[model samples]
Target: QSSNVPKLGTCITCHGRDGIGTSPVFPNLAGQKSLYMVQQLELFRSGARKSEMMNVVAKSLTDAEIEALAAYYEGLDPGK
Candidate 1:
Protein backbone atom coordinates (compact mmCIF):
# COMPACT_ATOMS: atom_id res chain seq x y z
CA GLN A 1 0.00 0.00 0.00
CA SER A 2 1.01 3.60 -0.69
CA SER A 3 0.83 6.62 1.59
CA ASN A 4 1.29 10.36 1.12
CA VAL A 5 2.15 11.02 4.75
CA PRO A 6 5.64 10.62 6.13
CA LYS A 7 6.08 7.42 8.15
CA LEU A 8 8.48 8.27 10.96
CA GLY A 9 7.16 7.02 14.29
CA THR A 10 4.49 9.67 14.18
CA CYS A 11 2.13 7.68 16.42
CA ILE A 12 4.70 7.10 19.12
CA THR A 13 5.18 10.74 19.92
CA CYS A 14 2.09 10.87 22.13
CA HIS A 15 0.31 7.49 22.07
CA GLY A 16 3.50 5.92 23.45
CA ARG A 17 5.83 3.37 21.93
CA ASP A 18 3.33 0.55 22.60
CA GLY A 19 0.12 2.43 21.68
CA ILE A 20 -0.86 2.70 25.31
CA GLY A 21 -1.36 6.36 25.99
CA THR A 22 0.83 7.89 28.67
CA SER A 23 -1.72 10.56 29.49
CA PRO A 24 -5.39 10.30 30.24
CA VAL A 25 -6.19 12.93 27.62
CA PHE A 26 -4.91 10.56 24.98
CA PRO A 27 -7.11 7.51 24.54
CA ASN A 28 -5.44 4.13 24.78
CA LEU A 29 -5.35 2.94 21.20
CA ALA A 30 -4.13 -0.46 22.21
CA GLY A 31 -6.94 -3.04 21.90
CA GLN A 32 -9.44 -0.48 20.65
CA LYS A 33 -12.09 -1.34 18.06
CA SER A 34 -10.76 -0.89 14.52
CA LEU A 35 -14.00 0.56 13.23
CA TYR A 36 -14.15 2.96 16.14
CA MET A 37 -10.58 4.00 15.57
CA VAL A 38 -11.15 4.61 11.87
CA GLN A 39 -14.26 6.62 12.62
CA GLN A 40 -12.40 8.76 15.13
CA LEU A 41 -9.57 9.39 12.69
CA GLU A 42 -12.03 10.34 9.98
CA LEU A 43 -13.81 12.63 12.38
CA PHE A 44 -10.55 14.33 13.33
CA ARG A 45 -9.63 14.73 9.69
CA SER A 46 -13.02 16.21 8.83
CA GLY A 47 -13.06 18.63 11.78
CA ALA A 48 -15.96 16.82 13.43
CA ARG A 49 -13.67 16.36 16.43
CA LYS A 50 -11.55 19.37 17.26
CA SER A 51 -8.03 18.48 18.22
CA GLU A 52 -5.12 20.39 16.79
CA MET A 53 -2.72 17.49 16.97
CA MET A 54 -5.12 14.80 15.75
CA ASN A 55 -6.46 17.03 13.01
CA VAL A 56 -2.96 17.53 11.71
CA VAL A 57 -2.05 13.90 12.03
CA ALA A 58 -5.24 12.39 10.58
CA LYS A 59 -5.34 14.83 7.72
CA SER A 60 -2.21 13.31 6.24
CA LEU A 61 -3.12 9.64 6.72
CA THR A 62 -4.59 7.54 3.92
CA ASP A 63 -7.48 5.18 4.58
CA ALA A 64 -5.34 2.05 4.32
CA GLU A 65 -2.71 3.49 6.65
CA ILE A 66 -5.39 4.26 9.17
CA GLU A 67 -6.63 0.67 9.02
CA ALA A 68 -3.13 -0.70 9.40
CA LEU A 69 -2.40 1.55 12.36
CA ALA A 70 -5.67 0.67 14.03
CA ALA A 71 -5.03 -3.03 13.52
CA TYR A 72 -1.50 -2.76 14.87
CA TYR A 73 -2.67 -1.01 18.00
CA GLU A 74 -5.57 -3.39 18.51
CA GLY A 75 -3.19 -6.36 18.56
CA LEU A 76 -1.12 -4.97 21.43
CA ASP A 77 -1.84 -6.01 25.02
CA PRO A 78 -2.43 -2.81 26.97
CA GLY A 79 -1.90 -4.49 30.31
CA LYS A 80 1.77 -4.93 29.60
Candidate 2:
Protein backbone atom coordinates (compact mmCIF):
# COMPACT_ATOMS: atom_id res chain seq x y z
CA GLN A 1 0.00 0.00 0.00
CA SER A 2 2.74 2.42 0.95
CA SER A 3 4.77 1.42 -2.04
CA ASN A 4 2.14 2.73 -4.40
CA VAL A 5 2.71 6.37 -3.52
CA PRO A 6 5.85 8.01 -4.78
CA LYS A 7 8.64 8.87 -2.38
CA LEU A 8 8.18 11.75 0.05
CA GLY A 9 10.36 13.94 -2.15
CA THR A 10 7.69 13.93 -4.84
CA CYS A 11 5.22 15.32 -2.35
CA ILE A 12 7.81 17.65 -0.82
CA THR A 13 8.40 19.64 -3.99
CA CYS A 14 5.21 21.58 -3.34
CA HIS A 15 4.00 20.54 0.13
CA GLY A 16 7.49 20.72 1.70
CA ARG A 17 9.56 17.73 2.80
CA ASP A 18 8.06 17.87 6.26
CA GLY A 19 4.57 18.68 4.97
CA ILE A 20 4.70 22.00 6.86
CA GLY A 21 4.24 24.06 3.70
CA THR A 22 6.83 26.53 2.49
CA SER A 23 4.48 29.53 2.52
CA PRO A 24 1.14 30.65 3.77
CA VAL A 25 -0.24 30.32 0.28
CA PHE A 26 0.15 26.56 0.63
CA PRO A 27 -1.99 25.05 3.32
CA ASN A 28 -0.13 23.26 6.09
CA LEU A 29 -0.77 19.64 5.15
CA ALA A 30 1.21 18.20 8.02
CA GLY A 31 -1.12 16.74 10.61
CA GLN A 32 -4.09 17.83 8.52
CA LYS A 33 -7.39 16.03 8.59
CA SER A 34 -7.21 12.95 6.42
CA LEU A 35 -10.83 13.07 5.42
CA TYR A 36 -10.46 16.64 4.23
CA MET A 37 -7.24 15.88 2.45
CA VAL A 38 -8.73 12.90 0.63
CA GLN A 39 -11.84 14.85 -0.28
CA GLN A 40 -9.82 17.75 -1.65
CA LEU A 41 -7.58 15.49 -3.67
CA GLU A 42 -10.58 13.68 -5.05
CA LEU A 43 -12.10 17.02 -5.89
CA PHE A 44 -8.96 18.12 -7.62
CA ARG A 45 -8.85 14.94 -9.67
CA SER A 46 -12.50 15.25 -10.60
CA GLY A 47 -12.26 18.94 -11.47
CA ALA A 48 -14.52 19.88 -8.58
CA ARG A 49 -11.51 21.70 -7.18
CA LYS A 50 -9.85 24.07 -9.62
CA SER A 51 -6.11 24.33 -9.57
CA GLU A 52 -3.87 23.57 -12.50
CA MET A 53 -1.16 22.14 -10.29
CA MET A 54 -3.47 20.00 -8.19
CA ASN A 55 -5.52 18.81 -11.11
CA VAL A 56 -2.49 17.67 -12.98
CA VAL A 57 -1.04 15.87 -10.01
CA ALA A 58 -4.27 14.31 -8.81
CA LYS A 59 -5.49 13.23 -12.18
CA SER A 60 -2.78 10.64 -12.56
CA LEU A 61 -2.87 9.27 -9.04
CA THR A 62 -4.93 6.24 -8.04
CA ASP A 63 -7.18 6.07 -5.00
CA ALA A 64 -4.65 4.02 -3.03
CA GLU A 65 -1.92 6.48 -3.76
CA ILE A 66 -4.09 9.33 -2.64
CA GLU A 67 -5.01 7.51 0.53
CA ALA A 68 -1.39 6.75 1.25
CA LEU A 69 -0.44 10.37 0.80
CA ALA A 70 -3.28 11.49 3.00
CA ALA A 71 -2.25 9.06 5.70
CA TYR A 72 1.39 10.01 5.42
CA TYR A 73 0.76 13.71 5.72
CA GLU A 74 -1.89 13.36 8.38
CA GLY A 75 0.55 11.43 10.56
CA LEU A 76 3.07 14.28 10.67
CA ASP A 77 3.56 15.95 14.06
CA PRO A 78 3.47 19.57 12.83
CA GLY A 79 4.59 21.02 16.15
CA LYS A 80 3.17 24.47 16.81
Candidate 3:
Protein backbone atom coordinates (compact mmCIF):
# COMPACT_ATOMS: atom_id res chain seq x y z
CA GLN A 1 0.00 0.00 0.00
CA SER A 2 1.18 3.53 -0.83
CA SER A 3 0.39 7.05 0.34
CA ASN A 4 -2.57 7.06 -2.03
CA VAL A 5 -4.39 4.66 0.27
CA PRO A 6 -5.15 5.37 3.85
CA LYS A 7 -4.30 2.76 6.46
CA LEU A 8 -7.67 3.53 8.02
CA GLY A 9 -10.30 5.68 6.38
CA THR A 10 -14.05 6.18 6.51
CA CYS A 11 -14.36 3.57 3.77
CA ILE A 12 -13.25 0.95 6.27
CA THR A 13 -16.48 1.07 8.24
CA CYS A 14 -18.31 -0.65 5.40
CA HIS A 15 -15.62 -1.67 2.94
CA GLY A 16 -12.92 -3.39 4.92
CA ARG A 17 -9.24 -2.48 4.78
CA ASP A 18 -8.78 -5.10 2.09
CA GLY A 19 -11.69 -3.71 0.06
CA ILE A 20 -14.12 -6.43 1.09
CA GLY A 21 -17.49 -5.18 2.19
CA THR A 22 -18.15 -5.75 5.89
CA SER A 23 -21.91 -5.79 5.26
CA PRO A 24 -24.19 -7.05 2.53
CA VAL A 25 -25.40 -3.53 1.92
CA PHE A 26 -21.97 -2.38 0.82
CA PRO A 27 -20.63 -3.80 -2.42
CA ASN A 28 -17.08 -5.12 -2.39
CA LEU A 29 -14.62 -2.66 -3.96
CA ALA A 30 -11.63 -4.89 -4.44
CA GLY A 31 -10.47 -5.30 -8.03
CA GLN A 32 -12.97 -2.82 -9.36
CA LYS A 33 -11.77 -0.81 -12.39
CA SER A 34 -10.33 2.55 -11.43
CA LEU A 35 -12.31 4.21 -14.19
CA TYR A 36 -15.57 2.78 -12.96
CA MET A 37 -14.82 3.68 -9.38
CA VAL A 38 -13.90 7.24 -10.32
CA GLN A 39 -17.09 7.64 -12.29
CA GLN A 40 -19.27 6.28 -9.55
CA LEU A 41 -17.49 8.33 -6.91
CA GLU A 42 -17.94 11.49 -8.95
CA LEU A 43 -21.62 10.76 -9.39
CA PHE A 44 -22.05 10.03 -5.73
CA ARG A 45 -20.19 13.23 -4.81
CA SER A 46 -22.35 15.27 -7.13
CA GLY A 47 -25.52 13.66 -5.80
CA ALA A 48 -26.29 12.31 -9.26
CA ARG A 49 -26.15 8.79 -7.91
CA LYS A 50 -27.98 8.51 -4.64
CA SER A 51 -26.51 6.78 -1.63
CA GLU A 52 -26.79 8.45 1.73
CA MET A 53 -23.53 7.07 2.99
CA MET A 54 -21.58 7.30 -0.26
CA ASN A 55 -22.73 10.84 -0.95
CA VAL A 56 -21.54 11.94 2.43
CA VAL A 57 -18.26 10.11 2.11
CA ALA A 58 -17.61 11.33 -1.40
CA LYS A 59 -18.60 14.88 -0.68
CA SER A 60 -15.57 15.49 1.46
CA LEU A 61 -13.17 14.02 -1.09
CA THR A 62 -11.30 16.06 -3.65
CA ASP A 63 -10.83 14.75 -7.20
CA ALA A 64 -7.29 13.68 -6.43
CA GLU A 65 -8.38 11.82 -3.30
CA ILE A 66 -11.10 10.09 -5.26
CA GLU A 67 -8.61 9.03 -7.90
CA ALA A 68 -6.23 7.85 -5.24
CA LEU A 69 -8.92 5.77 -3.59
CA ALA A 70 -9.96 4.29 -6.93
CA ALA A 71 -6.37 3.32 -7.67
CA TYR A 72 -5.91 1.87 -4.22
CA TYR A 73 -9.00 -0.30 -4.42
CA GLU A 74 -8.37 -1.22 -8.03
CA GLY A 75 -4.95 -2.51 -7.10
CA LEU A 76 -6.28 -4.85 -4.39
CA ASP A 77 -6.49 -8.58 -5.05
CA PRO A 78 -10.07 -9.82 -4.97
CA GLY A 79 -9.00 -13.44 -4.61
CA LYS A 80 -7.30 -12.79 -1.30
lDDT of each: 0.78, 0.82, 0.87
After superposition on all C-alphas, the RMSD of every candidate to the true structure, in Å, is 3.7, 2.4, 1.7
By lDDT rank, best first, the candidates go 3, 2, 1
Clashing pairs in 1: none
lDDT of the structure predicted as candidate 3: 0.87
**Residue 25 error for model 3, in Å?**
1.0
What lDDT is reached at residue 28 by model 1? 79
Which portions of model 1 show Cα errors greater than 4 Å? Answer: 1-8
lDDT of candidate 2 over 1-80, digit per residue (tens): 33455655566777886778787778788899989999999999999999988888889889888888999889887885
lDDT of 2 at 33: 96
Q: Which ten residues in a row have the lowest lDDT in candidate 2?
A: 1-10
Model 3 per-residue lDDT tens digits across residues 30-80: 999999999999999999999988898889988888888888889889999
Q: What is the lDDT of residue 71 in candidate 2?
A: 91
Return the lDDT, model 3, position 8.
Answer: 37
Which of candidates 1 and 2 reaches a greater TM-score? 2
Estimated TM-score per prediction?
0.84, 0.86, 0.91
TM-score of 1: 0.84
lDDT of 3 at 40: 97
